[model samples]
Target chain A: MMTLELYNYWVVIFLMMAGFYMLIASNHLIRKIIGLNIFQTSVFMLYISLGKVAGGTAPIAAEGIDTYSNPLPHVLILTAIVVGISTTSLALALVIRIKESYDTVNEDEILEIDRIADEEGSSA
Target chain B: MINEHLPALQVVVPLLAAPICFMIFNNRLSWLFATLVSWLSFAMAILLVMEVRDGTVLHYEFGGWAPPWGIEYKVDILNSYVLLIVTAIAAAVFPYSWKSIQKEIPKSHHRIYLTAMLLCLAGLLGMTITGDAFNLFVLLEISSLSSYTLISLGRDRRALTASFQYLIMGTIGATFILIGIGLLYALTGTLNMADLASRIPALEGSRTLQAAFAFLILGFGLKLAMFPLHLWLPNAYAYAPSAVSAFIGATATKVAIYALLRFLYTIFGSSFSFDYMQVQWLLMPLAIASILFASMVAIFQDGIKRLLAYSSVAQIGYILLGISLVNVTGLTASLLHMFNHALMKGGLFLALGAIAYRVGSTQVKSIAGIGQAMPYTMAAFVVGALSLIGVPLTVGFISKWYLILATLEKGYWPLTVLIIISSLMAVVYTWRIIETAYFQERPAGAAPVTEAPMSLLIPTWIVIFANLYFGINSSLSTDLASRAAIILSGGSLL
Candidate 1:
């Protein structure tokens, strides 16, 4: 069995790859948003994971307790998660609007329309 | 209380102004309030820069908790320079937005537009002032998200698509940055920039640290629109509302560059970034390539706004080239270019907003013969163009002068010649617009073009005059940029 320390770093890497995969490869607009969510969540996990230490308790004041996980990273990750949620909501809103205007959520179809618009303009 | 509280107030004032903008609900009142707040914040940034100019880093701890444990706002020479640039642009842009927003955005969404602008301002300022790496990511998202909203609000239906594309790319960039920050935290166990600088040397040789550095540079590089990762910038700048384009083009990516600069030298140390990692090897080539690529692409675009958008990418290349030199002169050149480019581009976009307001189109053919009608606006555009082309006695010339000297200092003379040649390319693209505006005669039976309203022209020329003023007497900007460069390269001024 791997030590807890080893597990923490490995888990962070796994989550990172998952997010990158969604961001780079996904086609559906909503799917890409989900990928971004997963990607950001993985960062949260990495930060939280690093804060954990062997034999450390929660970073709260307690009787007869000394060692605790670093609270700073945890605090930072909390703010980051909130920011992630806001960006996700905004992304979803933009997608809804894109769907309404373009009538298709695919990147390539949108590019085709834009290209056609450019061609028509140049021809004019 | 307010003396030490100035840094937080610089951001919090704008943050609070946004919600209040919504509560007022009248578009005109909201615009008035936004302009006032932007000007006030500009004043505060000036005062804060003066306060910190004595080489004292103003460290403000939130809730009375010290740094390395609690989040802190670290105000130093570099951030103050960025603060001045962002707020100065906001102040200059807000007055222009009064009429421009009415013409481009729906009247019903004016409050929304004002709110987004304020939030974007706050986010840019927060990114500049925050002393923590993770905090930098949070502020980066704050600005990026608001910016997406601002861009999508463009009158064009395709604006939504452009904003979505930007959202996708911006999110990926932020994620890469977060991963980089996470890796650093894992190795150093500290998120504060100063603390990380002190602690990272112990983990210098570790693979985790190296990987973290790589991720961080790549991530921030995307945000700053470093050549290959710059896909989001041009389209977003092209499609966004005029006011949005002017502000973000001037400040957003520059703030990201500041974040990159902070991370590279302040947190990771120059020895690690420049020597051990040799980041310049990659950055220098990409920077030179982007200058050529983006400028060439810009020259070919038919849409005037799209042309300026591509030009912004090329300007970013110049800033990066300065940073890639990894020396005092190079850093100073980068920092000064940050201010000068903002003034020039902001002026150009604001002028376009005026033209777009009067003529009702931003296409090159649409604006043909506008120069005879709106000579003042086009003249301002010419001044801005001259700066972009690095003409003598302009801000761009000062920046390029320092950069060429820096390159020659390192015996990279070929790059210096390339710099001059690329600048000639700038003349070509800028002349494209000038020729379209003046030399081309008006088509018969077309609608008569009139000058833009005083509101827009006043702000546009303010930025225009700023270009000339700083170009002539660059002692202030140059001094601050030099101090910032020293602080950055010295590794630990705290």
Candidate 2:
């Protein structure tokens, strides 16, 4: 039982690291958003996993139900999921604007353009 | 009856006003509504500070549910003081935004701009006042999202990239905070901050709890723009619309600092955070580095807004240094600096907005001889700059005086010298602007310019004058800050 309990945490940790790495390593803006989504999803999973109880039913406060999984984490994650969706949509909108202005979604390319522009600005 | 509901109304007024502002298509009407709601919130904040000034804590449970079940709005001396600063700055910024936003942001986006500003204001106030851990995260997202929108409203194309960078970094920070809160909840089975405070001490030896502490600090450090985690701040401040810059520079990071204080002292308890974890060991060095490095960087920036943005980062260092000291005078200094920095930075940014309004740019060279044209605005800028440099008879001076006294109390003489030396660096950077504005010859063939209109100039001067007024008469600010610090540090005044 203890090993199984820890296993869920281990998976959550692995997914979290993978997503964080992708968020940092990717230069493409949309890919970074995907990385953020994955990262947030792992956190959601962690919250849900924390709420689990053996032989527990849904948290409906029904008659004769002595054991129930925690409902609070579920509610918290529900709010978090909404927040995550908003963040993804906003990020995509920003990426669209960046693409329109800089003609690229890659971070390095955008920085290069900005560097050239700053030089021109200072010189002029 | 209304006084009892002040805590809830303080946030709800602005939160509800945001959607109403969104519904109103007219830009001027939306601006007026935001201004009205901000003033209303400020009035509510004042009443709250009065109510809680006698070392009383006001805890309001939502929908009449008790703690650990219902969300709580807890206002003590600490948070009420922060509430006053955040709402007061919003009130000042809204009226100032009218002309500044009109020039810097497109007309079509003006309604959206006001809505985002109000939402950002609401979220910040909510974050400061809430005692529920998860509610704080949700409010953090609200402010961060709206602010990203507000920053991208700047006419300059770089604003887009700046907002994107901030969104990425801020989302990571928020997620880290969520992970930390989840860990705490899993361990303690409670989300009410007061209840968590009581519970966290028993679980102090657990590795999971330790990791939660680390995550919370890192999360808020990023949000507070602590030293190395501050890469996203300067660009965001420099590229955001002038009004957005003023509002966020004054309030957003300050509220984050409030959150840091709340968690470290209120929830985790000062003994565990300061003595056991020895957070000062990590925070003090980073604070020193931020002060020295950011001040040096500020000296080299050509854009006035970027220069001030870097200066804002350095000022955050001063506040962090105060917190690291972990004593009554030190925490008092940190709290006082929060209020003082808001005034000086808010005024400085508003002055820059005025310059941007007439001169069409805030580049150092572009504003050459602006002193001769916009005398009042530049004068306000000069007063704000003097305060930034910690000159006597200014709010900056009071903060540095207490900070120096705090270092001395800790028997850290070298840090006292370092504080003085950094203020000298501030002198150099601020003098650069003064010289360029007043002494440098206006370039030939430049369009004739005049002082910024009364609408813009008045709000800028209000903050500038407040800096001087509070500096000369320190009783009000010092009294509240010291009481709050005593509560936070659990130490008596020396």
Candidate 3:
């Protein structure tokens, strides 16, 4: 019988795998980006869950708190959240440019166009 | 003040200079500022190497909080060597950019170009120096994001597409790395590499630890462009701006390789990573495949840039082969090849940049007879090509010799033979370029060829000269690489 924490971790792992699978399987680049977000958010939840203490309060040094959640994981997750945002923004920007150039967001179509371009380039 | 702050200043000075370069707002001023910033970083790297040569490690605590509290900038023979390679390539490329960028990039975009170049330098340097795992990922993003911008800024429409592809792949790589770090932190309750190293041993047999290792290797494998996972690389290199190609071809993947080493040896114990888990079993076959497959691909590339791009994949194979051997000598070979690959690949890309500057295209057909007119540039290419083929008296040869010796030491005889055959494949691809450049007749009505400007030629020669110099007198590189290798093999040695 796994503990609650172990169950949380397993759920997170499942979510991560589902996200990765969607990233690989999706034709739409935006959907791929969405998958990446899901993947990252699951990891974020894992981190936050690990930081919880049995009788802990919020990790702020306010009036008369005897116990608190480990502040380190919270602080680390803040940085992770910032990184995730940057990645999402960058992926969005790439998708926009990709759509402009290929007039499509589908991976198979873009790859086909690129392949045709290469063939035309060599034969010419 | 800056003298004592070599470790941080190596990254900071360039990072701050990028915005200042933009603020200058004039093309000439921007170019000058960018060049000065690159030289400043190079000088700082040299000083860091001098300070650490005595084997004393410098650990700079950020905000005066020591390890396990605040971030740290750590430097030893390993990262100092990488710092030198990154900055040295930047130093060489900055001057070359003046002539090359004028031809390839729009005059209006000069400020952005200079700013992006400086940012890329800062990111690579920061990634090399940081001792914290999360800090490493942040710097990795900084460099990876800036590099995508630099690549897309190229004139070709496909440049935009190439940059997009790289962004997708690079994002995946970065996310994987972050997940791995997150897992390690969750398991060990810390993000510092040194602290994690101490904590990891007690949990060696844990499934979480094993998963963390798996994620780290896979994530970094994408970043390093390890053999089967290298699909994103050749096109990215082939389509990026020439100067961008040269700088990244030299530095980006090498920094990833360094990060892999930091995690594998420093954070994860060598006994667990190499011996117990046997990562070599996976690394060995993949490295061999990359060498043969990428080289075979290179032999058929019509464009010089794409040829070198495939060749970069092959070169990465040699580095991994060195690493997979899992001994001090093998590690030395890996480290030495990191430097050696940077010089030769940088030189090759710069040579192609010069031709691209002159002929307006990198298609080999365009440059057939131009070699006669651009003799100095072609000569540099020949020297670079010789280095790439690993001929004696070239830096590439020295690294390959060490790699072969390392394999033999491990009693991998078939592997030794494979290494030799790959070098022969290298010979074929290099000879193809040399034959096309010098022997074949120029296509009719080709433009009257003039040599690449002295600015580009001088910097390209700096690497070419280093290649031969290191090839003959390899003691400096060998000493540092071997020492770093020993440190990586186990903390027990120290």
| Residue-wise C-alpha lDDT for candidate 2, range B246-356, written one tens digit per residue | 999999999999999999999999989998899999999999999999999999999999999999999999999999998889999999999999999999999999999
Off by over 4 Å in 1: A1-11, A57-72, A121-124, B491-494
TM-score of 2: 0.99
**TM-score versus the correct structure, for each prediction:** 0.96, 0.99, 0.96
All models, DockQ values? 0.73, 0.89, 0.55
Candidate that would win on lDDT: 2
CAPRI class of candidate 2: high
Docking class of 1: medium
- A45-99, model 1: which lDDT tens digit per residue? 8778778877999988999999998877787788888888888888888888888
Candidate 1, residue B444: CA error in Å?
A: 2.5
RMSD of each: 2.0, 1.2, 1.8
Better of 1 and 3 by lDDT: 1
Query: Between which residue pairs do clashes occur in model 3?
Result: none
Ranking by lDDT: 2, 1, 3
Name the docking class for model 3.
Answer: medium
Winner of 2 and 3 under DockQ: 2
Per-residue alpha-carbon lDDT of model 1 for B281-344, expressed as tens digits?
A: 9999999999999999998998888999888889899999999997899999999999999999
DockQ of candidate 2, scored on C-alphas against the true complex (2 decimals):
0.89
